[model samples]
Target: MGKRHSELLILKEIAELLNTGTNMDEMLSGVLKKLLQVTELDTGWIFLMDGDGSFQLAARENLPPALCYQNLEPMCKGECWCTDRYNNGRLEKATNIIECKRIEEAIEYNWGETNGLTHHATVPLRAGEEKFGILNVGSPKKTFFHEDELALLESIAFQIGTALKRIKLIQKEKELALTAERNRLARDLHDSVNQILFSLSLTARGGREMTENEEVKETFAFLQDLAQEALNEMRALIWQLRPQGLENGVVSALCSYGQMLGLNLQTEVKGLLTLPGRVEETVWRIGQEALANCKKHSQQSDAMIQFMIESNFLNMLIKDSGCGFIYDQNQELPSLGLKSMKERTESINGDFTLISHPGLGTSIKVRIPI
Candidate 1:
C-alpha cells in the first residue's frame, strides 16, 4: 500500500477503539494492541499522566524482557529523556527516535534481555496545551523512523488526546447532574417532611399542656420527644446530601455533622488542609457514614476523627469507644454502609482499613494518596 493509504488504514482501524466509552484502561490497551498490530511495531506503551505529573503505565504491548524485569519496574517509575522533554514543554510533536533510558538501565544492571530493541519514536499527547502524556512505538533493531511514520504517530496521538478530554468532560457533566439532583431532594425533604415533623412536635406539646390526666400528659410528652428526634435526624440527612458546610472545609463540615448526630466529637488534624477536591469529597463522604454508623451501632456518645498527612497520603482515622461487633470476612455487609465507604476509597485509588472486635470500639482508617 502507498504510505498515505497505509497511514489512513491504521487510523481507521484504531479510531473506534479511541472513541469507546468503556473503561479507560480497556480502551487504552485495545488501542495499543491495534497500533502495534497495524504498524508492525515490535513494542509500544502509553503513559497516562495525572495533573500533578505522576503517571500510570496505562497500557503496553509486546514489551521486551529487559523493561519487564522486576514486574515492569523500570518503565513504571523514574524520569527519562522523553518524559523530561514532555514535562519541560519541548515535546510538542512527534520526534525522531530517542535513546531508551529504561532499557539502558536494565542492560547496565544486567536485569534481563533487551531482545534487540533500542529506541522508539515519541509523540506528545496533548489537547491544545493540556498535556496527557506520550505515545511510544518501537521495533527490534529498528533504530530510525521515517518522517511519514512520525507524522502518522502524531495524528494518532491527537486522536487519543481529544478522546481523553471528551471523556473527562462527560464525567464532569455527570457529577454536576448528580449534585443538582441531591440538592433538589434535600430541598424537597426539608420543605415537606421536615415541616410535617415540626408541626407534629408543636401539636404534641399543645396536647400535653391542655390535658389534665397525668398519663395522657406523659404520653403527649413522649410523642413530642419522638417528633423532635425525628426532626433532628431529618436535618442531619439533609445536610449530608447537600453538604453545605463543606465550603469551609471537610473538617469543619464533619464537626458540624457529628454534633447534629448527637455524638460528642473530638477531632485532631495534624496537616495542612491542602487536598485535591476529589480526595476531600471522599473524606467527607466516608466521615459522614462512619459517624452515622457510630451513632446507630456503637450506642456511645463519643466519636473521634483524626486527620493526618504523611508521605503524600491523607490518613484518616474514625474511632469510637462504644461497643463494637464482630466482623465476618466472608460478607461485606452493605447494610452497615461499610461497602459504600470501601468503594468510595478505592475509587480514588486509596486504601481502607476496618478494625473491630466484640466489646472493642471500631476504627476505620482511610489512606488516600494525593
Candidate 2:
C-alpha cells in the first residue's frame, strides 16, 4: 500500500478498536498497541490527568528495561520537560517533539537499552478545549518525528480524547440517575414509612396511658419504647438515602445523623475537611454502617468519630464503648453489614480495618488518598 493509504488504514483500525466497547482501560490498551504497530515505535506510554490534577500512566507498550525492570514509578509527578512546557502554556500545538528526561536519566545510570533514543514526541489528547492527557511515543533510532508522522499521531490522540469525553459524559449521566433514584426512595420512606412509625409510637404511648392492668401497661410501655427506637432508625435511614446536609460538609452531616439516632457522638476534625464528592459519599456511608453497628451491637449510648487529613491521605476512626464480638478468623465470618462497609471502602481504593473483641468495644478505621 502507498504511505498515505497505509496511515489511513491504521487510523481506521484504531477507530474501530476504540469503538469496540465502553471499557476505557481495554480501549486505551488496544489503542496504544495499535499506535505502536502503525508508527513502528519501540515504546509508547499514555499519561492521563486524574481528578486530583496528577498524571497517571494509563497505558503502555513495549516499556524499556529501565522502567519495566527498575523501580520507576508508574505515575509521573512534579515537573518534567514536556509536562512543564504544557503547564506553562508553551505546548499549543497538538504534536511537539521534546527531550525525554527519563531516557537521559537511564543513559546516565547505564540502566537499559538507550541506544540512539534521545527525544520523544508528545501529542496533546484533547476534545475541543478540554485537554485529557499526553500521548508519548519514542523509538530506539528515531530522534525526531516528521511532520506527516506527527499529524497522524495527533489524529489518533484526538480520537482517544473524544472517546474519553464520551465515557465521562456517560459516567456523569449514570451518577445523576442514581442520585435521582436515591432521592425518590428517601421521599417514599419519609412520606410513608416514617409517618407510619411516628403514628405507631403515639398510639403505643396513648395505649399505655389508658391501660388499667399493671402488666398491660408495662407491655404497652415496652411497645412504645420499641416504636420510638424504630422511628429513630427510620429517620437515620432516610437521611442516609438522601443526605441534604452533605451539601454543607461530611462532619456536619454526620453530627445531624448522630442526634437523630439519640447517640452521644463526639467528633474531632483535624486538617482540611474538604474532599471530593465521591470520597465524601463513601465516607458517609461507611460512617452510617459503623454507627448502626454500634447502636445494634455495642450497647453503648455514646460513640466517637475522628477525622484526620494528612499530607497525602484522609483518615477516619469510629469507636464505641459498647459490647464487642469476637473476631475469629476460622470460627466466624464477617457480617453482611461489615462486608458491605469493607466493599464500599475498597470501591474507592481506600483501606478499611475493623477491630473488635468480646467485652471490648469496636473500632472502625479507614484511610483514603485525597
Clashing pairs in 2: none
Consecutive 10-residue window with the lowest summed lDDT within model 1: 327-336
Taking the tens digit of each residue's C-alpha lDDT, what string does model 2 give over 1-370? 6876886787788999776558888889889988887887878888886545557778887777765544554234445676765666676555556678877676676777655667789988888988887888888777778898888888888889999999888888998899999999999999998999899989999998998999999998999899988988788778888976888998888887777777899999999898987898899998988887887888887999999999668999999988888886454337988889889989988898888888888999999887
List residue ranges in candidate 2 displaced over 4 A.
2-6, 16-20, 51-53, 70-79, 95-98, 107-118, 213-223, 323-333, 357-360
Candidate 1 residue 19 Cα shift, in angstroms, is: 3.9
Q: What is the C-alpha lDDT of each candidate?
A: 0.87, 0.82
Please provide TM-scores, in order, for all candidate models, with all chains considered together: 0.90, 0.86
Query: What TM-score does candidate 1 get on C-alpha atoms?
Result: 0.90
* lDDT, candidate 1, 1-370, per-residue tens: 6875885776787898778755777878888887886678989999877766677898898998899988989988898888888877788899975679888999999988999888999888888878898899999889888998888788889988888888878878988898899999999999999999999999999999999999999999999999999998899889988987788999999999888788999999998878777788889999999999999999899999999988678899999988988877575754649989999999999998888877889999999988
